[model samples]
Target: MAFVEGTGDEFILTCFVCKNPFGLVAQFCGYCQATRQQALGVERARASQQIISDEPEPQPVHNISSEVNTPAAERVKKQKPKRQNLFFQNMRLRLDNFKEWQIKRSKPIGATASALFIAFTYVVIQTYIFVNTAPTLDAEKYLYPAVTHEVSYFDASNSEPATAKTDIFPVKYLKWSASSSDRWTTKASWNGWTGKADITFTPAGNLETDRPVLAQFTAQYSTYWKVFRKITWEPASPAAILKLSYPNDKNLTIYFNGLAAGSISNPAVAAGSYQMYPGPFEIKFYNLNTGRLIDKYTRTYFISTSGVFSPSYQN
Candidate 1:
């Protein structure tokens, strides 16, 4: 017998008649000189038959409806794990896209919100200042007209008006005017003396001294003339007169004891009277049309018996 080396599942076989496998290298058996092709063909047919016989027998097929109705067939059905994984992947992609979008828009959104808040706050503050802090025409009550008084004393013993003992009391709202204008003059008569006076006032003009000058006069005497010779322009009680000498002919508001007393407009003289007391008072001047504060005066004043408190200012 003879053998040969080979690879894989194939091997060179020896010829049975010659007992020689060297015939694989040639076309015939070396010892018996038989044809190798015929022998190889017979061996291949036998191997095929052996292989076919060794295979297991096929089982019979059952009815399709019966197999579907069985529980075991249902358990063998394919599970779609890939579909579940694809669904989760889509959800994750959407979440990532949303995160990227938020990051890109955050700066502009934040800046816009901040700018809006600042603008709103500024508008609110400006409105508050205009409504509350700015001056208004309703506050004109604090510029009321001031008060004034004139007092006179006469003596009957002297013959001439100049030589006669004459005492002129300081009167408020007393102003000087050119000799021609007869616009503001108050005339009154007592038992022994005739009184005539002129007051010139302009809030926007210069202030001039208003001293009383004696003119020609005749004296009349009666039984009660000596006792009743003193004449006063104020009430008999101890009250004080406040006089404001402003140069302009405009509307004014007066404040007494830090409270709004009243208002006055286009007066020849600005004057008012109050009960005689000592207290601190404030006076504020405002422009009637524009609602602006022009000037202010505050003082602690005392009012004695028959005293006049005169505060003067020019525009």
Candidate 2:
């Protein structure tokens, strides 16, 4: 039955000479089909041939079907032609276009996504630092050790912890008394004026001496050397005593000449040595307890009194 196939939707066309399905839905054999295509070209050339007025007109071929197809070919003439579905064809075109667009845009989309991710990461890191890291200063307690040194005061005020600016006053106003004859009565003092504000001193080293060197002052500033806002001092001798008496609470960092000494928590500091010479100092008074910076003085001075170099620090 396949040998007698027709070119219908359910039937396939077959070659008469080979007696096999041609696989193509056409009337002729494969070899014959090729020959027909070549003949069609020859026929088209012949039909286009025309002569000038002097030449005789060529006769056109009439009934060329008889010349191309023999009587026996009519018996194998196939029926029906295959048609493609319009919707499926359009869908294929759309899929092809979509694939092309994706290939072209993939790189830009990926780069944009990566940039957004990096930006987000930077924002997160900045937020973390803002929340956790603390600056190296607290101003309100710069000279008052009681406010900063007392934990209860900080708790009540709810202040942030601060870094110490080791340099307070440039001069060592409190010096060791060499004229002391009594081992328990020798004294120390300061002579600079603080304009309108009261001055105070905080010792950085040994406050005790060979003589009584009475550890008291005429005024509050005479006890506290606050002339040069930032200062340092060096001792000719190692056991030189320095005394700093803070009437109230404050936070301050004291340095021994050029070396880093330590922090002071006591309001009244006595019994210290040359290490008490707070020199090479810097001051930024930020009150961590109050969460603000106040007492912003910008003057610094160093002076020598009675063969002794002292620092007078100012706001």
Candidate 3:
């Protein structure tokens, strides 16, 4: 039956005419101003009184006996559980069907055909889509977003691959030379300082030049350039790496050029650095626990002589 159920207090009653809870013991429903007796099904066929009425009037006297019901709010809450259960039932059925489809797809014949299809698709995408998709970038910024190129390189003689920070806008393509002896050297002359390569953004373009330049050089020493796509350019700076050799007794906070650079979270490692210019910089180490100055030094930093900017600890 559509009706409000009253709890504990007799003075407190919920008027079915408006579904508003009222604490007044009165003859009329306080909220809807309906005759309290008629709304409670105590009387029927009373003139439909209107006094700021927002709710439907209580069921007719004749219909009240068979179809009276609880408040709409309570009915909605009771239905939520049924709806949730039905939704979960449908979801479980879908998951089971998906599992069955996966099992069938894993059968030997299907699996082999699927694997071949996937392999062929991957090769095609790599050869055509990826190759053409890797839009050529200049020494400056890469073209915006539609396509990308992640240019990296490695020497055939060396195992480690070399990459540079692409986050730098308007890059001059100068730092990547640190990876090879001549980064762009094709001369028959192979030396310790000759990067055999130069700082260049033309990772794939190097192929054309590599042939003509290395024509005189030994083919035995080879370098490979690999380019890919999709990269997020984040803000970064040229960091001056300062390696510390002395073992520390406690964690120390480092300051560079009189500004707080960072703190040594791991006291065990004596080497790390901060982002600063390559020049004379003041370094001060303070006790992380007590904030007392320990070691202070003004170290002159310069790029290492090697083509690779190998950082050495300044004593």
Candidate 4:
């Protein structure tokens, strides 16, 4: 490199870049306009471009066997089970939190849950006890079977059956048979329960015929139902009843089961109406003025629970 200023002289140098003669300047070649450093860089670039590169270029690293064995879709498939397991675990944790919250809500909530559990346990225990209790073949009246059944009866020489209406649900049919003088039985079976209806009669005597009477029927159970049954024992009705009108009270005296009931003539004779139970009663006729008994007859009779004794026997 050379420099000149205001010397009134012309000088020249050969350009290293273009190989042309150049006028003297401070830094650049005049012919090719290249600096010293630029010329060096261009020469190095040309030299490198001319050289033959025998070595291969670098590439990304990968396992060819692993890529072949495990495809992208198959790897994604393998990860699904793990994700599902995590989901289930999260759900269980949420459920546990919910359970804790419910139990901790209030005293009433806990108490209600405990009460329900206790009731269930009590019912289970009672069921076990009832089933395990002595198999005494106790009698039970199943309301469902009886309610669904329509029964007919013939009492005291009656020819026709009791009801004129047909059966609502004729799911069962049983033949009636006389078991004894005062009792009748029927063969009936339903819903895993099998038994006969044992009906007892009250010796019913007539108020009009005096010697003739209709039988009062009473039904009884034959077997115990030990499963899922609600039972309530009902009292048996009176076997007989006697009704006496007013004004005729003075002439009649009634006895129920050998016990003196009241006189129709008496002011306190149950308002001139005398009803009795157990049957086999006595009716005595008397004279009001003489206090002398005119006639007396003892007989056995009864009536239905809601019906008065009217001697309904027909033979």
Task: Give the Cα lDDT of each candidate.
Answer: 0.39, 0.33, 0.38, 0.37
List the candidate numbers ranked by lDDT, top first. 1, 3, 4, 2
Off by over 4 Å in 3: 1-160, 163-246, 266-277, 280-282, 289-292, 296-298, 303-315
Model 3 residue 99 distance off true place after TM-score fit, in angstroms:
99
- Which runs in model 1 stand beyond 4 Å of their true positions? 1-241, 244-247, 266-275, 296-306
Query: Which candidate number maximizes TM-score?
Result: 4
**Model 4 regions lying over 4 Å from their true place:** 1-97, 103-112, 124-183, 186-240, 244-302, 305-315
lDDT of 3: 0.38
> Per-prediction count of colliding residue pairs?
17, 52, 19, 8
Q: Compared with the true structure, what per-residue lDDT tens digits does model 1 show for residues 1-315?
A: 346576533337755334445444566555555566544434322222322223354466778998778898465777777545887889999999998998999998889999999988866654453333211111111111111221222211122343232233223212223222333222222222332212223222323333222112223223333333322222122233455444353565544444444554644333543332212234555556775655553334433323466766545
Q: How much lDDT does candidate 2 score?
A: 0.33
Task: List the lowest-lDDT window of 10 residues for candidate 3.
Answer: 212-221
User: Which is the winner by lDDT between candidate 1 and candidate 2?
Assistant: 1
How well is each residue in 55-95 modelled by candidate 4, as lDDT tens digits? 35335589989878986776644334334588889999999
Instruction: For residues 1-315, write the lDDT of model 2, one tens digit per residue.
Output: 245544443335443333344444443435434222222222222223321223254566678777567677555768688798999999999999998998899999889999999988866654454333211122112212221122222222222232111122223332333222222111122222221212222232234332111111121212212421221111112211223322123455333322333334531223222122212223233343663533442122221110123333442
User: After superposition on all CA atoms, how large is the RMSD of candidate 3?
Assistant: 31.5
CA lDDT, candidate 4, residue 310: 35
* Residue 15 CA displacement from its true place in model 2, Å: 80
For model 1, give the 10-residue run with minimal summed lDDT: 135-144
